[model samples]
Target: MPPKFGTSGLRGLVTELTDALVARHVRAFLAACPHGGALHVGRDLRASSPRIAAAVAAAARGVGVEVVDCGAVPTPALALASTGAGAAAVMVTGSHIPDDRNGLKFYTPSGEITKADEAAILAALDAEAAPAPAEGALREDAGCGARYVARYVEAFGTDALDGLRIGVYQHSSVARDMLVDLVERLGGTAVPIERAAGFVPVDTEAVAPETRAALPGWAAEHRLDAVISTDGDADRPMVADAAGRIVPGDVLGPLTARLLRAAIVATPVSSNTLVERMQPGFELRRTRIGSPYVIAAMAEALDADPAAAVVGYEANGGFLLGFEAPAPAGALAPLMTRDAVLPILAPLAAARAAGIGLEELAAALPARFTAADRLQEVPTDRSAALIAALTDDPEARAAFFDTGAAEAGLDLTDGLRLAFENGEVVHLRPSGNAPECRCYVEAASAERAEALLAAHLQRLRDRLG
Candidate 1:
């Protein structure tokens, strides 16, 4: 009964996002769908995801909905099964969250839920949703995984990566072997770090600080192009340069967007640095944040212009749906989830075609760098109040003009954003995808950017408090 609809989907701590809660979500979702003959359920490698998926499966089957358990597969695979099977799907994934967190996202045949449907689902959840008696038995589906790998092979053929040495950091990541297989099939030399069978908490951005220090040396020793890895779900990507510094998602996204000529449908929380450097007519549309927002926008765009939109990705470096044009191998349909493998392979292909390296191309993108951080005083309940108060404040209004610049505009589509003269800007918004109240800042330099962000964050935090 909290907000069932965030930018992406309903997500919360495992404490509240329990099996009972997900049961309610599943019941409401099935009730909303028109032709729910079969429901596809998949989960990530998260410790809690399997449990949640079981609950969701039981809940759906309890309502007479046939269930196809796709097992531990990427979200894209689950989504593809739903769309391919012409069935409703629910993914039990916490995607990139710290342990102790989990979430469930629903798809109604089209790979995503509409805002209208989202509101309805929340309303339904607020009311009691008793589990109905089992209408159908749950069955395991093994075909989804093979179909998933086939989709990737079709999109990115093995011709491009004939011989390149790559090392996939094999922490407890699900995609560790998937990536290795993809690389091998693509004819790349893949070296995987030995992985344990247990769960590994990997934060795309919260990469181990030691990895930072070791990255460059490792790249030099191994002579690698990039350190490609994913969070637990394999939905979001985290890349390290040959020197081993984690490339921020904001930076990685546009690179992939530009490479694929991706007419991006992204959220405004992402930095506009890519906008400044992109080629003329590099199409982009900003949604709020999360895959659902971007996915909904892409659906609309595809409806309008089908072939022109090659791919859709996000600033979080989640390469959403993409089209794998006809290859020598076969026809490839893009997956509808935020995929880690695509971003890795796509940009590397770009660098290869351009006769450059990932690091060098990264250097040329743009000067602007944006960072996402939460103001300590601003919590979930207070974020909305802050954005509303700041946007309507008389003093804040006057202060805006004081920074005075001609030919600049305001962008609050997702957050309280004010674009300034020198590309120095501030964004105060709630993390629609997560709990924290986020404030973003981009400036001419790192020091100035941090300072400006800190000052602005302090003022908002004080005000919110």
Candidate 2:
């Protein structure tokens, strides 16, 4: 199978991402950009990342570009350094995917590659490849990582998290050490746990059941105030309260926005509806379910009002700031790419300032809850056909939903989102990178949301089977 760009970046099974294939994609990317400066290369802690990074570096050298080895850094760190230096970068990571899967994310000098950029890269794929260099001179750069760490330390100050005892779930996330360092520097007791030798794909949005169950036990063991973690690439955060309940990203996004005093906030349509009701004073913009869409919306918001603090976040808790905002400690610089640390630390700082626990801050929001699950191995074409039939015909929709009532409304922005008469929402879309169908549900309570998602997904599974 050929590696392709997903909602995030290029991803595929480890077996499919052969060195030759990665080199081809890297060559195409370099050709599309036509940059002469050093191409910064970074990787995560995935078992295959080092090999993949070597392939990308070789490809860059083959195209007569220098390679700056930012070695085993977080994706956002690579983006920050590359954009600042006006150089392109390629990060070897599979993000939240399993260990058997890995991929690449390319960033231009400005930021993440736009949809237009993806098209250009894809167009260049068939072009004649440049001659491979027998040996490529690779320069190692250790400053990028430190600079990334300093960004938070300076913005939030060293005492922002004082008196907090935060547990760091040091899974195979590349940012594990950085998070621990940050917490300790900020006067918090950083308790590190669950340091895994192998890669662990920690998806913040739809956390694994076992992970959810262990959080409470871990919290009790360490007497922790909260637990913090990130996805494989450390671009998305997973934060759990003292009771071991993970706060959904949508809820955390709004809370972070409120803490930043953002004037305009952008998020995906699949985010919790509570965001709309909770942050009444700020302008809320909803886009399609992808970072690119959310980033574009945030850019528009910032362009309209340059002084307005515009921020965007995904349902996975990756926060993006379009402009510098007032932090509790100081002013934060704009980081257009998705970042895990800011969301994790900012909410904690806000809760501390408010003299409340993270759980209490989350509870202050409206009682809307969202749950998501995916039907694996469902073909994309079949998922598309099913969605189209359900959207085009009310009878089909009613049949699928098992309700005789007519559809309340239909939203086809990114997928088939049906709003029923009973104030429940169900969204169905094909996974961008994998052969799966994802379903998201929002209801009045946590139990209802989970029940809705379970019932809907079970129905989908039955139909697919």
Candidate 3:
């Protein structure tokens, strides 16, 4: 498939993202966004990232835009540094997708581009462009990674995680070393485990069964208080408790917000419903799935009340701070982009502060449990047809669910979400970044949620077959 805009960025198979194609997109981005000064470029640990990032830099320089290479850094680190310098950025990362695929994430000086910006980029790709008279200079910026770590240390204090044994699952994540550095700086024993030399596409949202099985063994062997890791670019976090039980992102979002004492929180409709029940003191807004939608909703909340402490998170565990919030050491400046660091650190700090284990801290949340998985290699058109059929026919929906209970509520915000009278919830949507059909289910117990997800996914697989 050709490189095209997805939920977060422009993505396609690695073979499809040729140098010529990458250069064209970068030039189009420069034309549409119109950044006057230097542009920042960063890449993940993927083998193809360096070559693609070089292509991006060459293309930007061709258009007379100074390029600053922030090599081999997390997505948020590059975003923070470029935004601070008042320059736009482009990250060469496929995030949590497979190694055979890759992508480009664009950021304006202000922050991430909106859906309108996406359309503008597409339009600019074909429009005529003016030639530049001079070539631009390219330089390197190596301190962005350290500065990103400093942001958290200064806010939460070096002793925020004092006396904790945290396991860092360094599974080829770009932020693996940074995570270790951050944890150690914050007064924790950073036990580096499972450090893979090759790239690993560890999707935090729909974790694989092998990874799910491995976490517990590692945690037990290391006697870790918790295990933490991130996706390829380190934007989405994966956190497991002492018992190796994974805490979903929806659970982490509300807990982190409560820790920050946020006045307003925005999340996608597909997130865990427990957020509303857990954080009744704060105003909550639900948007469609994707960081762009969550960021837009957060911006709207801040517009309504500038002084309000606004934050956004997705089911993938990427937390976005929309406002400055007070911390022990100082205040955390807003970085209105999806971040994994804050969510990971906040819960760990909070658990230690309360003199409780990570397991105990998570158990205090509402009993609702959520489980998500996907049918991989499924065609997008097939998934869309399935959703459209279920949406148009009530009987089809009922038959698909195979539950006798009536739906108490129905939401078509981003996908087909139905709340059954039995207090169970199920949602279905096609993966925005890959060829997969995802299903999310929530129930009073974890077993029930997993069972429902498995049954529904089997049904989908059988239908697609």
- Per-candidate TM vs. native? 0.86, 0.96, 0.98
The Cα error of candidate 2 at residue 224, in Å, is: 1.3
**Candidate 3 structure lDDT:** 0.91
Estimate, for each residue in 369-424, the C-alpha lDDT of model 3 and write its tens digit. 99998898988889989998998898898888954579788899987999999989
For residues 1-465, what per-residue lDDT tens digits would candidate 2 score against the true structure? 356788988989899998889988998998897444679999999989999999899888887788999999999999999988888999999898788889989888878888888899999988997665554568999988889988888888888889999999999999999989989998899999899999997878778889998999999999989999999998899999998888888888989898888888899888888877874667889899888888889878778887878999988899998888888778888888999999999889988888999999899998998888788777788888888888888777777884233468888888899887777899999888777788988888888888888889988988775
Clashing pairs in 1: 64-135, 215-243, 215-244, 216-243
RMSD of 3: 1.0
Return the top candidate by TM-score: 3
lDDT by candidate, in order shown: 0.70, 0.87, 0.91
Candidate 3 TM-score to native? 0.98
RMSD of each: 3.6, 1.9, 1.0
lDDT of 1: 0.70
Candidate 3: residue 389 Cα off by (Å): 0.2
Worst-scoring 10-residue span by lDDT in model 2: 398-407
Q: Candidate 2: which pairs clash?
A: none
Q: Candidate 1: where are CA atoms >4 Å away?
A: 1-3, 34-36, 126-134, 193-214, 262-269, 322-331, 375-378, 394-408, 444-465
